[model samples]
Target: MKVNCPTCQSEVEWSAESPFRPFCSKRCQLIDLGEWAAEEKRIPAQATQEELERALPDIEEIEAMLAQQGDSFFRDH
Candidate 1:
């Protein structure tokens, strides 16, 4: 089967042989990655404040945990 590459719009073979199945080549794949990294492409969604709060740790909690863990927490594990 063949499908259009999301990055370059080139036809790509959807097979195990094609390492970048959804993209034509590594360049195209990287281009797509760059776009996502740069926030040029975004997944459409509407998140509530409650959802956002639940998804992220509080800054105070993070600071307290880091203070308790100390520098060794990052170096050792």
Candidate 2:
């Protein structure tokens, strides 16, 4: 099977012989990695309600936890 490299659009043999099967070469692979690292590429989606809830603690919950901990949280053990 063959597929175009995602990074360079070069034809690539989809096999073990092609280590970078989806990319033309290490350079192309790195370019794609860099783009992703730089946030140039991303999967578009909205966070689900469950996802949003799990993303962070509620403000009241945070305050309660902080009150429970008092100033001990600021001290080093």
Candidate number achieving the greatest lDDT relative to the actual structure: 1
Instruction: Identify the runs in model 2 with alpha carbons over 4 angstroms from their true place.
Output: 38-77
Q: lDDT tens digits, residues 1-77, model 1?
A: 99987755668999987787687765454444443333533322332334434433343444455457563522212
- lDDT per residue (tens digit) for residues 16-69 in model 2: 878876775654444444443335333123433344334433434444544565
Least well predicted 10-residue stretch by lDDT in candidate 2: 40-49
How many residue pairs clash (N, CA or C atoms closer than 3 angstroms) in each of the candidate models, in the order given?
0, 0
TM-score of 2: 0.46
lDDT of each: 0.51, 0.50
